[model samples]
Target: MTRSHALFILMLSTALPQMALAQAPEAQSGDADILVTGRAEKLYRATDTEIGRGSSDPLDIPQSVQVITSELIRDQGARDITDLYRNVAGISASQYATVTYRGFRQDGNFYDGMRGDPFQGFAVPSLFSIERVEFLKGPVGMLYGASAPGGMINYVTKKPQDEFAASLRGIVGNYDRYGGSGEITGPIDKDGVLTGRAGAFYEHVGTVQRNSDTSSLVLDGGLGVKIGPDTKMTVQLTRYEQDLAGRLRGIPIDEDGNFLADRTWNHLEPSDYMKLNGTVAQMRLDHKASDALSFNLSSRWFRYKEDQDYHEPRPVSDTDGDGVPDTVTREFRRQHRNIEGVTIAANMIAHVQTGPLRHTIAAGGDWYWQQSLFDGVSTRAGVPPLSLTNPVYGLVPVGGYDLSNGSVERSDTRSHRYGLYAQDQIDWGRFTLVGGVRQDWFDDADPVTNTAKTSGKRTSWRTGGIYKPMQRVSLYASYSQSFEPQDPSRQSASVGGPFAPVASRQVEIGAKGELLGGKLQPTIALYRIVRRGIVQVDPDLAPINGVDQMSPIGEVTSKGIELTLAADITRDWVLTANYAYNDARITDSAPGAAIDNSVGGRFPNAPDHQAGFWTRYQIPAIDAAFAFGGQYVSGQLARSGAHMKGFTVFDGSVTKGLGFADLMIRIENIFDKTYATSAFDARRGAFVGRARTVFAELRVNL
Candidate 1:
């Protein structure tokens, strides 16, 4: 271990006893529930959250954190994270397999409070086993080291219950879609010291595109044991597999942002396919050592593998001496990857008193190890160009191509990360102060080359305050910093060595409150985030071996305002609404930076304005509920200055409770709106959003 690391550990050991002794003698029990449980009629208010690590109330966090409750997920029939976009402000799904939040791309996915896998190049997790989703926005490095500046999304899984319960559900939808899922939970011991839960789901679905279908399966199980009066341990396991036949590449668009072909067009061969398989196992222990202190330890192991063989269409070119492009070519490619990782974390929460102020202090240390192998090959020959006006299918020969002998590239990489952090929330009368600091060390190596390519260390900090002027209102402001290491593979050879980590900082002010006799809740926030040290091609250095040299560029900034509202308007009615306006651009760049010419350009895929609203009503006499919602996104710029038109889509659902089951019918894109959900480049192509679709589901509980 390095000297710096040893010193850090020594300091942490010395502070532990001081923190415990500082606790108040009259402190309350430390058994406060850590999970957000129990369903609410309205979607607005959440009393507790795990985002703060210590389950602090949202109003006291001084940052923007949105919770998509299980109730809301069911009402919207959400199948994946993307389906929840209508409920979250300032977030958009991008074409490059990542989500754009506040103009920054985020590819991190977390399960519970620990890091999971990279979101890109993988299928979205099933919602059947997820209890809820939490989105924490802004620079959160102090709590979660080495993360995107925009934010992170966390999935909280369901736990075993002491009482017996079981549920079964079946679903059928348009486009030849069908699925079934079941879950059961109960006690395994008469004394209730042991409990178990299990869930499984299978789905076969067809897409609007021709010859494209998907099959998926997921299995989850967990066991919980109460070892002592104040201690509990749980073990969980999950397995998931998915296969997609004839996956579709996006359709190309014209200079005017008009689709060159039909929205449902499939550019890939019918034989192309993609598959994903993964397994995860986790163990957790929670113990309340004393009335003023608690400890939690969790460890997880994950293995994931994926394979894909597909074809993509190239841009149209004018071959007939005409201004308009009339021909396009297709290229075939294949790729395979395997990833494995392990993570462990230990944390302690202490309720202490300093003078006349009360404090909740949390300290934690985490470690992660990951290894990955990737192989790829692509055909050198391209398919003949086809006519733009009249396309021919099955014209290209596929039997003669040899994939094994094609151009091949393979690599193996391993990485390790360690982090230690501490945070304290201090309360004095009507004012609350929050402060935190974290240090992280990271290393990456390539086994094929037998070299350690990169290593680094960094520290992050955050400070904020909250003031409650009334019983129902909180006003707060905060500033935080984050850092993320740049992959050496992406850096130019001219850099000579590993590039410096990208740094980001944010300043935010927000207000949250309850109104109308606790029936209504609202939140508003204004924030600015700035990112520096982004890698860019060095204009002065010409390409060597077809690769350009790179250097650190200036800064990019995203500033925005957001508003959210949730209300239980009446005994039978609930409503949720949100709106956001974001302005993101490159503020500065080096003279020789590749993006220097486009420093003033807006960030791609980031819309300037977005708004959405959903409302549901229940009829007690008939035991039925109906919901309707609509979302709007303003025009956005593509990567090459092309403009994408704004669009609005509507959705509706109806549910009726039967004696032993509940029936639900849902329709999305009620008006069959045609729009581009994401784009590659201006001339390359853009993904078409889903057309009007319908689904019917039946759920039974025992």
Candidate 2:
């Protein structure tokens, strides 16, 4: 064998024991009976096993749900939650992100199924201590007040484990970007019931775009206590900071809508705008009341501030007759509003069996409140000469005339939301029935205008069933309804005042099967979703799309099929794959718009074809493994040709464990694919996604 192959095999042999010990596989009995063992265990379906009868298993709730496990994250070598979602199933997302569910994009994200909002426009979840990502599709109104119909994604953080363990990991990759992260989890007491886990990460990210770069620092820590009985409690803290410099650049398109020839880094020499910075602080608490009940509460505080210099030619129609040049400079400044929020929730389950009938009832209630306070000042950058006559270019600058220093008003507002929900599962013979109902209420303390601060109340429900005629096959279907509040963040007075509430309905039918001695699991589903009373900006209030207008647009519908498969073909080989086919379109609009244009056109950012697969093989003799995976998304149009277009990308990784540390090498966009991460303005087309890049990491455990 070649020297490299021999070395790889040698490394694998030495790492086997450690790899096997990282996680204990699902046990048929014993400690596995506990419900809150690990976040991933509650979310991920390791095989074809159906999570029946409990609210803890979100999947059994009859709503669309996607879970990205810690194993998947490790294999993919993802640094952030964004990278993880790129490969998730039945989900399409934009770069200008919002915390949301399903394919509907919202800006609100959560932690451990609790509330987490953007602080200073940069609150993307950092994966420093994350365990798994759960995308709960549809309105989670029962658990989170005022949620978007699109749903919400909750990052379940990694908590303290029963055993003593420690790991230190480092990465170096493209753009001169480098980072290191570490974690330690173990018992703080002799009983091993009280445990602590701490982790931290920092990185200097290079921007391929000229005059642009991002560097970040993050710290996370947590402690968990197991009480004498069945109760447990946890407390955690997180702090993060990011800085962006240069001209936050994006791919430019030609008049014909063709991508610019320049895809390589550094094509534009930034002319005006300068630097930006963002920081955030978050804290959380999780408590389990008993084996059948639990409660969670969390809070976060965020602040953002920015300054920029805008330069351009003076507004002179050759008035000065200076044909050569008439350059003038304007300074721009922004003080971010502060965002703070508190969330509290409870969940419970009641299970009983009588004869051949089994019944499990799950119920819960939640309340969430958040407030945004704006306070800051923006004025001319420097003192301008008091004179306006004989306007000399450099001699005396005009004070108030400097558009750069214009001051904007700031304010404070609070919103309150609450929800109560219940679900039941009934089993008879080989058939199972699931049904649920939820009531949601949303109230705004600051209505902006005398528009009579409105209160929205809605009842959402779902019913579904599964049939297993055979030991290896099952058939299932479900119909669910959800309603969401308008975008409160970007709400203009008119839209938020008179606009109708948006409601969504979904119908799905599917079948799941296990083949080859339960070694392979496959699922096929077909679903249709319709949204009504969609909210959109009132023409009169269109204050620069994507920037100031956070109002709703009309209505839309999306239909598609999802296919997923996972298997262990052999004892040492594992495979996973998923595919989605979506047809999303705007259904209705206001006024002089074209006929089918508003009702039948494609929805922006929803790709027609999306698929992914990953396979891994372990050579038992050597403690080493090899894995490969990639995703493909077909071209898609944003806002019906308003701007976005179709694109695709692929990613891959490889890893080895030395005697003392594990080494991982990853290639993102392995084909060097080019595509849009997001595009807000059709006028600007699509903001290109990341380019082909590579990274390597070495991790040591103590």
Candidate 3:
């Protein structure tokens, strides 16, 4: 570790006491019934979740779910959802929003339980107005419909508060990083029947990568109105805007895994640019029919547009047999895309008792529609090659080539999914049985002609039993199934159209404990997931720009175990830790596939071993706090037998509470470690990790 960074952390150790959650007023429990469980007063310790639809005790839910609370976010100085993933087991990330959960890839994160892309076209979601982030691991198709086998990330955003509140925060750091945010929430009516909240944040940043600079802006607000005493309505709107230039894809590597160039280097032209604009609107209505029943209706509208032009690296070759890669092949690529979607969901929840069983039943239906138009093109033959040691710039044209002719492609498609789901939790004293089922119909069509291209259906289900040997403790086992519709464009003449959707299933067993009067919560889980219905390129069909039609023909199996803990040792001490061991490999595949997803090969980015730890201590008398944490990942395969070496990065911070504002200093990558967030073959290098970053922030609450 760097001496200067170490000294800063040393100063923090002596400057703080008690974390913000232990003393802050706004850090109260978000769910109304969660506080009734016990005396666990630690904000870092999670006791309940709403991932399965409604507020529920985590121990009662059979699946492994993880929560990152607002208090934890503040204490860790987390700037986005990705920052909190270190505390979650079995998660790996690539550049941008591509994430690997367990052994599978999730297209994007969800917002308030709805399936959608938060990183739609580079509008990377940030953490300005989020209340908490929940990660539900393993096959959620029974509830969410047609999703990745690994899991889903649900972002619970901030809503109107019950009382008047306001806060402001600002930060400044290296790489010209500077940003500020302000938020306000209060009752808008004298009778306390109407409430409203609003917030805005903006940031401009430069990275260690040369010529890479970017900025983002977020504006959000919401209103809540109580209709009589039995009903409530909430309406929210959020906007996102981002502008970027010279974004680095990754650093190319050789057989020896030696760096070809400095981390700051990239092959993209200095003038290359990318931009994203998005807006989201959401509404929810809740009504209580009687003491034993309630109803909920929620809907969302999402729209985004992104534009990009850059130099993408292709496979590196050792044709000369020198062990070192000859050069980074560069190609000019361009894309312009627009996305629009809407989703509506309605559900009913009931609490009832039968002769020998008490039941919590929930039934719901959802309708989702999305339309997209993307124009893309890439140059292959004429693109220049980037030197490993020295590089020249600006040889490729950036201002030309719309997706119009032979090698160019324009995708204009629309899709809709309809789902019906029902779930029941049966409770008889200390034993609980939960069962759920969902049926989904999916259709894809051309947006312009409105002609159907493909249609499919899937039925998914989950069943589990939980046994509580003692109060606040649970042991559980479950089996669940999931499915994802295959895209129409992937169909080939050989395999034909109307292919079945990809199917996934899992078996899991776990135990949970809420101890120390809610001060500590721990979980241990083991599971195996199997996935079938893969897509392989059809040599029967010709290729365009090296891309060909595909047919389904593969299977994969992933087994893993996870151990996690969140503890509030005392009023002044809090910590969270996690470790995961995963074995993910292909069990079947076509003889010749386009890429390296072959039989017996491990999934890319799914590290065999990964772990993280974070702890914080507070000195209440002086209103000071100290936190230290680090993340470690083991070497793992990427693709084509290419592997990424692993490294550990440490982060530490200290905070001092003033009457109106808290001051904090945070250091990321204290050791200045150089690693990759994602890796690829010799042609494509690895995404370089950021170097050491030091920043200071001031927060004010009133």
Candidate 4:
């Protein structure tokens, strides 16, 4: 055998145990047909959720829910939640931290079932203290107030445990990448009345793109107190800082809409950078007055500050009439922003028998407030021309920016929202019905003057029914309506008033079952979503008054089928797979819409076909685990009609169990494929996918 093959086999023969100590798989009963529901009972399979039904039985719920458990996160070596989206059916990745669900691109991220955005502009979330990520599809406005109509993604954080445990992990990879993380959780008192946990993660990594590197530091700590036999309280705090010395705006496409010749070529110099610093504090109280009644109250406060200094490629010209363009103009800009928000939610659940049915009723109220301040943007400076064929750097001095040129722009806005909602789940033998209604009132105001700029109100509802044909199988159908407030700034007095809120409706039918004693969990859903009142730019108004006016006449629809499965084929085998077929199209638009934006045209970044699979198996003979996975996304068009290519990437990893430490080697993009991930029109170019990358990690648990 070759030396490399011999070494690989040797590495796989030595074993100890899995190193993820935060969560341990539950011991199953000897009965192979027994049904089970627990967080880690079957590795990747989830039994309950905190998002839709508040830890209710999955089979009885009529909503589509997906989860990424801790075991899956560790085995896949996912550093951020973004890396886990593919495992969830029907979720399409858009640029930045945005994602498309049900045909609508949205920024509807949450924290612990509340309104909190861990990732800000140009920044990503750190999974240092996260336990599991939950995806709740369809409209949640009935519970979450104003949000994207497509769905919502919530990040559940780890809490202090009564059991004592600690772990330390380190990672090293190509491109001079290395990082480490440490975590500890245990009881602080001998009586076990109080518990505490702490974790920290730090990484400095570079990418294949020139001068594209990022450094990040994240710290999390939490405390839990058992106040009484029926009441408990928990608090969590997190601080994060991430910096990029060089911004990766994306590769600039050529005149013919072709991607840059060298994907690694970066037009922005290393001197340009962005920094994001954020802090969050949250507390929750759980109280049970009786077996049929309970209360959950939560509050969170967050502040995020961002600073950016970057250059953008602007107005391009061919100089000559030829279709092949050559020269490019760049614009240099700087900005500083501050975002602060607060959210509070109080919910009460009660179970009671009425007539021949048992009812699980939930009532809640939420109060949310947020304000943003932006300033310190210098005047846009002109830089030397660039070539579409070849590029030159260092022509514009970093200090050449003139802040006194009066081109700076600033805005300070604030919003206050209040909501009240009530839901009822009626159980009648093998049938379950759920109905909910919510009313939300929001006021957009000036942060400094506290003057109301605009106000609006919305009422939303969702209803569904689940029928269990078999003991472990359920068929369900649901319909929901959602609304999102429009930006107050978009309201021009000349246009009468603020545009109507973007509204959405969806009809979904699905099936859920746990086969093989709950070792195999599957959910399949077919849904159609319609969104209206989307605002778009009007070129006629912009030229008429020198100010762009937006018209809210855009509409779109999405129809798709999604299938997700997680299975424990054997004692040591785990698998997760997903597939989706979405047909998203524009149904209506304004007169000024682009050629590609006509009716029946495909939606931007909404791929027609997407599939992903991941699996891991432990060979008792070798005492090690091997995993392989791949992702495929069909080609899609940008909002500006630029067609971005699609791609399929494969990844593999080998995990070894040592006496004191677990070791892992992972290779991403095994074929060294080069492809574009997304595009925001041809001028801004496309974001390139990660090239072949190799990383190794050693995790020690104590």
In order of listing, the candidates' clash counts read 0, 26, 13, 0
Q: How does each model score on TM-score?
A: 0.90, 0.78, 0.89, 0.90
Task: Please identify which of the two predictions, 2 or 3, would achieve the higher lDDT against the true structure.
Answer: 3
Model 1 misplaced stretches (Cα beyond 4 Å):
1-44, 319-322, 382-390, 449-452, 490-496, 537-550, 595-600, 682-684
The CA lDDT of each predicted structure is 0.79, 0.58, 0.79, 0.78
Which candidate do you rate higher for lDDT, 2 or 4? 4
- Residue 641, candidate 2: Cα error in Å is 2.2
Candidate 2 residue-wise lDDT at 218: 62
Clashes of 1: 0
Q: What is the lDDT of residue 265 in candidate 2?
A: 30
Candidate 1 lDDT, 289-366, residue by residue in tens: 998999999988898888988766776788789787766776677889899988999999999998999999999989
What is candidate 3's lDDT per residue for 80-119, written digit by digit as tens?
6668778889997755777778977666677888855546
Candidate 2 weakest lDDT stretch, 10 residues: 26-35
Task: Please estimate how well model 2 matches the true structure, expressed as its whole-model Cα lDDT.
Answer: 0.58
Candidate 2 local lDDT, 7-74, one digit each (tens)? 53344334434533653342112321111222222223432211222334332345555667777777
TM-score-wise, the better of 2 and 4 is 4
- When 1 and 2 are scored with TM-score, the better candidate is 1
TM-score of 4: 0.90
Question: What is the Cα-based lDDT of residue 675 in candidate 3?
Answer: 83
Question: Between prediction 3 and prediction 4, which has the larger TM-score?
Answer: 4
